[model samples]
Target: MNKKYQVFISSTYDDLKEEREQVIKAVLEMGHIPVGMEMFSAGDEEQWKLIARQIEQTDYYVIIVGHRYGSETEDGISYTEKEYDYASSLGVPTLGFVISDDASWPSSRIDKSDKKLKKLEAFKSKVKSKLVHFWESKDDLHGKVSISLMKTMNLNPRIGWVRATDAPTTEATQELVRLSAENSTLRKKIEGFKTIEQPDEEKRLVHILDDNTRKFKVRRKSDKGRWDDAEKVRNTLLEIFLMIAPTLVNESSSKTIAKEIAFEHVGNNWFRTWPIGDNKIKGMIADLVALDLVQPSKKKHSVNDKEEYWSLTKLGNSILKRARRIQLEEGIDTLEDKSEEDF
Candidate 1:
């Protein structure tokens, strides 16, 4: 809905004519209405009531306090301060603009009267307690008003004025109210669901990797001699992941262990080396993550920023201990669906 908010601009007029004009321009440009005192009135019940009624109707109450302290009441408080008090009491969304300490102005604009200066200082202090913005010059005030008003309106939206014809009918209003309550209820239910812990990563990983290890069998090169070659080992990326995942401790050790596992399992012997390719290792790691077996840590080594690390999850740890105990239990290539790890 295209609604215009009425913002009551409360400030002394004569000393801040330029300031008020800038504020009015800022408010008007943003499509909101600005209300301010055009004529000075005496401190009386009728005048104050009129001002209070205006503040009550406004969506926002803004004040720009300069050096001059305007006419005061019998209680010695400025009329501007009285207006601020009324606005504050009504709980209006108020924005205050105070002149900086180093701001330069004409002698006429400056409050030379010691009593009025003290009251102005007190008023400034009161405004500072709320949402107060600082300004040094007219140009600075213009920019500040524009930015501050934009931000304030976004954060604290008000019940703005609209044409009576544009307003919703009572029946439509009732429907809207019903929908609003239902929406709130649905939001609370969604929030309750958010509190529930997500599915276990470990269990999912173990399921994908269950009994999936590659089988390997070693044979003696000579009839009466010890085994010499790992040539019989299954050459698969899953085998590499199985080899290094269990031994991993922290970030620094995972890569070192991965390379070592690749070299030992893939290379087979000390003399003839067949090093595992980095690309192959990387691809297997990616699959492991997709399976949720291992998660890459977000933390980086202080000395080596580019260093990457991964750790096995809870189920990964259990799976690590179980090794290739697939399902069946006894054979050299065993554990093939013989236990809970089969899942």
Candidate 2:
């Protein structure tokens, strides 16, 4: 009987980082899942498809419009507005929060370009056309979001997700059990007769070298004791997988994975500094997901631990075992930076 709704938080990044964090915290405090594009750009068709799919899956959509209009696509529409339009088209129960016009805000956070400012004004107008809340500060936004969401959910209840164990065992479930038993019998009759082959695309993913490598940028301290310019670092999927596989032997939070990677590459002192941004770390994890190596962990955690968790998939574990075997055969004791040819 426990159901959790998923709420999508859409807004411009960097400028609204604190606001988004507060919103996510508020959603989690309400005991629902909060999903967003914190790690994605939503610029390309493929990215748009992913965003659309996520929006479709969410029970409610929350858009926070601040000063910045956000990065635009080729059509000159900001991705934030694009997301709002798509969510509206689907009639997803929406909650809009716009920064109060009279509120004092950081100049750095405001749009500098005349074009972006125009777009921001238009976007705010479009959002204000609907029932929306105005907030002057992050705390104000958090409080309003919590109260508004509770009321909206009461007025517009949604069929959300529940744990498998929580699902009612009804006649359909009994039918499924019967069908599963019949399927098991059928499988026994044809065991080993035909090998199940992976899809060509998935099989190709295993051999594609380009797909196996990802680049991450990190900022290191310069000789003058100041942060130097960011530099690119590339790692093969196998290398990255091995780097974090130990920590992920169990379900580990994304923050934990980032810490492990940072400590391994940088040092413990700088790991806390997070030489690489969280989004870039998530990009690394996303790559593993594309390779079907890891998946989001569904295990319950305390609400205080807001970070998303991940676990190694069965295929990932198999690959890890194989890699260990190869290491043993090659007398490799520890993971070391190797050329692309090594992978």
Question: Which one is best on lDDT?
Answer: 2
> What lDDT score belongs to each candidate, Candidate 1 first?
0.67, 0.77
Against the correct fold, how does model 1 do in TM-score?
A: 0.51
Cα lDDT tens digits, model 1, 133-172, are: 6678987797667756765675477998988888999999
What is the C-alpha RMSD, rounded to one decimal, of candidate 1?
Answer: 24.5
> TM-scores of all models?
0.51, 0.50
* Residues 159-258, model 2: lDDT tens digits: 8899998885798789989999999999988885768954644334334422466777555543222235555577666667777775564566676676
In model 1, state the lDDT of residue 45: 52
How many angstroms is residue 252 displaced in model 1 relative to the true structure, after the best TM-score fit? 44
- How well does candidate 2 match the true structure in TM-score terms? 0.50
